[model samples]
Target: MIEQRDVVIIGGGHNGLTAAAYLAQAGLDVQVLERLDVLGGAAISAEAFAGVDARLSRYSYLVSLLPQRIIDDLGLSIELAPRRYSSYTPVPGGDTGLLVDNHDPMATAESFGALDAEDDVVAWAQFYEGTQHLARALFPTVTDPLLTRSEARAAVGDDRLWDALIEQPVGRTIADTFSNDLVRGVVYTDALIGTFAPNDDATLLANRCFLYHVIGGGTGDWNVPVGGMGAVSGELERAARLAGATLTTGAEVVALTTEKTVRWVDATGVEHETSAEHVLVNCSPHELARLLAAGDAGPASTADGAAAPPAEGAQVKVNLLLSRLPRLRDERVDPAAAFGGTFHINETFSQLQRAYDEAAAGQVPGVIPAEIYCHSLTDPSILGPELRASGAHTLTVFALHVPDRLLTEANNEAMRATLQRAVLDSLNSVLAEPIESLLLTDANGQPCVETKTTRDLEHVLRLPGGSIFHGDLAWPWAEDDEPLDTPARRWGVDTGMPGVLLCGSGARRGGAVSGIAGHNAAMAVLESR
Candidate 1:
């Protein structure tokens, strides 16, 4: 028998759940189908290693892009705790490191002054001041309808800020502003996170990544979720259920048609057909193209008749269960304060470019430039009593420039082992003790340094090409030829098919843990009605 629903969400990830919650709140009957037995998708937590007794944010760690407005509207109980520090980067062969203390600017300035980049202290503040203004004018527009580029310029209200961030390359801005190599890397990291773009490149891909990273909640601070990343999706799931939405796990949608008919199989392998008035997709754009193949409809082409930008993920996620924090090679900084925020290793400006050059030449960086964060330092709620009492911690290391092309099916395991060794070696270079010595052993006595290579993410999370942003991030403003009047087209959530919309990171202004895509998708459905 064919079932009827007002809305059918294709995936049960956080974005999908967000869309379902909003639509159901609007009095629409929404049903969400998830392929996995559990929800949250990549934004999930797990007792990854045996005998660890710790809930690790297996993937998609931390939160920033999720706005408070979405929380209040959904009446969610998710809490994002601010970190005392923003970032700490160890200087080579030095007792001091660059620490950006969130609560103490004097200390941060002192750190910058030690670097002999005294001018950067002022430049750093001015840079963020511009971003703050940009965020004020732009962040609110994310959930609202999209604006043309000219309208966006007017909204930002600062020609110099817009020209530096939007018109010119982010690398140029960083290079011209910051003189120190380390400081340049720190500022440029915002643009390069999860992106494969080089610093000297002219592409605006890095600019889009930078804009999104800095514009989170208008302050651009990435906060730690109090109870692992699962807490985020859990709240969204709760909101959806409270609003009378139906969510089914282990129900993978296998087929779809342009008429809003979806065919999926449940855990029992029993296939069912359902029809909805509207369908919201929370998967990658490529995945959506495959789902709609039966209907002969696909994503719209750009004005230049080019296919959508290539979406290739460029990161290697290493999740470590440490028995204790490794002492820093730099004697001046405490381990807790350093690891509480992003701890950078081997990520200087030239080194980042070198890593990109190596990857471009089909080789991995010898000294992997990665960032690490310890969630337990700020919020230990994600840990069980046993792990917490033992002072065990979870360290999530995200290494950059490892594109999907490097991890082939034939050599995935071998390459992963090699990369893990390289990561440990890199960490040991900056630490007083070898990181491997502090690793927690599971019941089988296996080292608890688990790694998710680009291929692993591709297989496990279904992030096509393992791209975390789902697809290449689009510019927040309207393109030159994009329709000005079409709400769906302008908003970038429109799938271009009747009764179809996007509610995932692939959508415009979508990335990180932000629910803007889902919120926009629901708005599109409501406005259509």
Candidate 2:
């Protein structure tokens, strides 16, 4: 029997759930299909340590881009804890570090003075002042229909700021704004997160990535989800289910036709087909191309056209449970405070450039630019009472400039080990001692340390090329000459097809923990009706 519905969403990731919730709540006959047995895709929280009680956000950690509108509209009950400390980057081979405390401007200024970049205290403030302007003028437009490039620029109200951040390479502005290499790197890292771009890339891809990181919620502060990332997705799942969406897990969607027909196999190996008036795909564009069989559903490339380059993620994620927070080499700063916020190591501007060059040359960064943050310090609820009582802490390391091209199917295993060692050595450069020495053992008599490469993320999470944003991020606004006639184009969720729309990270405003893509897709579907 060929069942039919008003809408069918492929993939049960957080984005799919968001779309299902909105469409079903609007009274559409909505059905969602997921390949995994569980919901939450990359946003899941799980007990990473076997027989241990700490639940880690296995893939994506932290939240920034999720807007207040979605939470309020869906009535999601997720709690986000903002850190008082913004970040702390230790000077390589030095006993001092720069700590940005949100609550104490004097203290932060003093830290900058200690680094002898007393001039930057003012430059730092001015730089972020521009970002806040970008945030206020641009953030609200995300939920609304797409705006033209000229409109978005006029909204910023600063021709100089818009020209610097939007028109030019991000590295040029960073160089002009900050004289200190470390401080410039701190600002530059935002551009490189999940993207493999350089300081002077003319494509302005890094500029797009930088805007999303800072414009989130108009404040740009990345917060810790009180109960790990799963709470975010769990609440989303509940909201979707309550909204009358038919959410099915283990229903592997193998094929999607140009006619909006979805074919899937259930857990018991039963095949089923469903057709819908509209289809929402929440997977990577590459995977979408395969499902559509390169059909005339627009280009299946990542974010660009059919000629878009293959997607590749740049970073290595490591999850570790330490018996206690490791001591910092900078005795002036408390280990709690350093680990509480983003802890930077070997991520100086010079280091990052060198790392990018090395990774481009098919090698690991000799001193990998990485960041570490302890979620338990912000919220201990993810750990069991016993584990909390034992003072165990969770440390997640995100090492940058490590691209997907570094790995092959044959060398994945060997490369993972090499990547882990490089990460450990890089992290140890900032610590007083080795982090492995502080690892807690699981019940299986193994150290509680796990490293994830792009290949592993592909195998485990099904992230195409393990690209977190699914592909290169497109501008949130359309060009003045472009047509916004269709509902899909109007919302920036169009997949270049008549019926199938992108409701995942592949969308224009998609990426991070943001539901903008899913929300936009739902609005597009509603507009079409």
Error of 1 at 494 (Å): 1.3
TM-score for all predictions? 0.97, 0.98
Best by TM-score: 2
Per residue, candidate 2 scores C-alpha lDDT tens digits across 1-529 of 9999999999889999999999999999999999999998899999998999999998888999899999999999999999989999999999899999999999999999999999999999999999999999999999999999999999999999999999999889999999999999999999999999888879999999999999998888899999999999999999999999999999988888778899999999999999999999998777787777744344443233423545899989999999998888889999988877898888888888999998899888788899987899999999999889999999999989999999999999999999999999988888898888999999999999889999898887667777898889888899999898899889988777777898989887999998889999999999999
Q: What is the per-residue lDDT of model 1 for residues 441-464, given as tens digits with 9 covering 90 to 100?
A: 998989998999888987887888
Clashes of each: 0, 0
| Shift in Å, residue 237, candidate 1 | 0.3
Best by lDDT: 2
- Which regions in candidate 1 have their CA more than 4 angstroms from the true location? 294-310
Q: lDDT of each prediction vs. the true structure?
A: 0.86, 0.90
